[model samples]
Target: MIFDCLLTADAAWLGGRELAGPTAIGVREGEIGWIGPLPAAPDATHREHIEGVLLPGLIDYHVHAALIQPEKLLAAGVTTVMDLGWAPAEIWPLVERARHDPGLPRIHAAGPFLTAPGGYPSRQPWAPPLVAIEVDDPAAARRAVEALVAHRPATIKITLNSQAGPVVDDATLHAIVRAADAHGIPVTAHTQGSGQTRRAQLAGVRVLAHTPWTEILDDRLIADLARDTTIISTIDIHGWGEPSPDREIALQNLRRFHSAGGVVRYGTDLGNGPLPLGVNTREIAALTEAGLSPTEVLDAITGAPLRPGAPADVSVVPGDPIANPAVLGQAGAVLKGGQNVTDSDGGG
Candidate 1:
C-alpha cells in the first residue's frame, strides 16, 4: 500500500533510547505505519532522505503553554508539552486548539496552582491573582481540586513553597492529593524550602514540578522518592543564564536522585524565567552535568517511543544528539502527525 509520507534517515533513534542504523519510517493517517530499513517504499506520495538522526519529537514536561506561541515549539522539535500551571479559562482554549491543529505542539495543562492563602505565586508579580487558588483547609483543598477537575486538568499542581510564604498545611496537602487520586489524576508539587520535598513525597505527590533545589536531599529520601515520584528537571531556571547556588544544589540533588534510579524528565519552567521557547540546551547541559548519560538525557526529553500506531511526530537533526546534546537545538527537519512542519534547512 502507498503511504502519505516517508522519511529515511542514516540513523534513527528508536524511542530515543537505542539507535537503529539506516532506517525508514512510513506515515499514514497521522500515525507511524511502518519502520524498517531504508527504501522501504519507493512509490510513496512524498519521500525525503535525511542525512542525520531521526527520533521521536521532544516532550517538555513543564511549561506555560498559554504564555508562548505553539509554533515556536513546533519549529524547535517539541511535539508535546505538559503545561504545569495556567488559568483554565485562558489555557483550555490553547489545549483544544493544539489537539486539532497538527502544526502546534499538543498541550496538556494543569490550570491554576493550588496554594495556601496569600501563598507563593499569588504574591509574585508575574502571577496574576487568578493564577493561584488559595486553600486554607482540607475542605477547601477538596473543593479546589473538585473545581479544577471539572476543567479536566492533566494533573493537579500544588505549591509547597514555604520559603516564599505560608504553604498549604499537611492536612490540606493530603486532602488535595486524595481528591486528585479519587479522580484518577496525578498530583505535581512545586516543592521548595527545607523538608518540603519530603513532605510532598509523604503526601503521595506523583511528580515534582521542579527538582528540589533549596536543600540537598538525603540519600534515603532520594531512594524513597525514586521508587514512586518522577521529577521534572527545571534546574536551569535556578541559574537563568548564569550559575548560582540554586543551580549547584539542584545538580547535586539530581545527581544523587538519578544515581538512586530516580525518573527524570526534561522541563524548563519556560515562562518563569529567561528560558528559550523550545529545546533549552542549557537545561540539557545541566542534566548532563547531573550525571545523566547521553542516552538517558535523550530519553528524558523524548518522553515516549516512536512505534507503529504512535503519533507521527519526529525530529530530524543534522548530528547524533547523543554525541553532542547541543545538536538537539538545531532541527534539520520536524514532522507532526505525518506532516512536515520544517524542512532540512530548518525552514517551514
Candidate 2:
C-alpha cells in the first residue's frame, strides 16, 4: 500500500490488549492498511509521531449528527457516529460531506424514527418532520421500514412509547421487525412502558435503543434480552442533572441488565436534551453505577468490529489507563483509518 503518515507510540489499547513497542500504522485510501510495531524508517520517509494514546475510532452508537457538526466530532476524536434519529433529507447532505471530506466524522444514519400515528416524537417541539414516520398498521409499519431501507439505512428504528400517545401495536411492531429482518437489517426500537418492553422482546427486535427504565425488568426479560439483543446505554440522558424518577429507573434497570450479561454499548444520546456534544463523562459514570468497570466500559465503546460488510480501522488511548470512571470521557488520543487526529493531547 502507498503510505502517507507514520505514527509510533509506546503501548496502545487497540481494543483487546495493550500493544507493546513502538507501533507504526500505514494509512492509504483513508483506511488502515498495516498496523504493527514500528518498522525501520526508510531514508527521508515522512511521518507524524502522535505523542499520546492511539485508540480505535470511537463509535457513538447513539447520537443526533445535527446536534454536533462533523468537523467538531473529528476534532474531538470521534471518527464514526450513528445518528439515532434525524431528518434523512437534511442529514443526507451532511452524510455526503463526511463521505468525501477527509477531516470530518464518517457518518451512518438510521434515516428517521419509526413511530405510531401519534407517537412520542410526533408532538415534540424539536422533532423534525423528516425525522419521524408514523405507522399505525402492519402495512404502514412495513412501508416505513421499506422507506428507510430504500434510503440505505444501516438499521431500523421504531418508537413504541405510550407517553407519546398512540403507541405502535404488537402486530405493527412485529411487521416492522419482520420487514427489516427480511432485508438483513436489524431493528432497534425505542421501547418504553412495561408492556412495550416485553412486546418488543417477543417481536425479536435486535436492540433496545435505551435500557427499559419505565419499569424494572424481571429476570426472565433480562435473560431473554441477554441472549437475543444488545441494549444501548443512554442512561446519562435520563435525568441530566438531579436525581429524578427517570434516572432512578434507568439505573435500576441497567444494574439488572448488566448482571444478566446483556451486551451493552456506550452512548450519550447527544442532542437528545442538554447533554454534551462530545463524549459525556456523566454517561460513563452512569455505566460504572450499572456495574461496568473501566475496562468493560472501554470495551463497550472501543470494542470489536461492527458491520462486517463495512470494516473500520480501530486504535485507542495509549496510556493513563482509565482507572477512574469520572475521566473516561477524556479522549487521551485517537487513531482512525490509521490516521492520528488527537496528536499527544490525548493526555496519555
How well does each candidate superpose onto the true structure, as a TM-score?
Answer: 0.94, 0.88
- Candidate 1 residue-wise lDDT at 131: 88
TM-score of 1: 0.94
Runs in model 1 deviating more than 4 A are 15-18, 39-43, 343-348
Candidate 2 residue-wise lDDT, 75-121, digit = tens:
65667787777887787777787776656677887878888887888
| Model 1 agreement with the true structure over 141-220: per-residue lDDT tens digits | 99999998888899999999999999988999999999999999999999999999999999999899998999999888
| Each model's total of backbone clashes | 0, 9
Give the per-residue Cα lDDT of candidate 2 at 14. 50
* Least accurate 10 contiguous residues by lDDT in model 1: 339-348
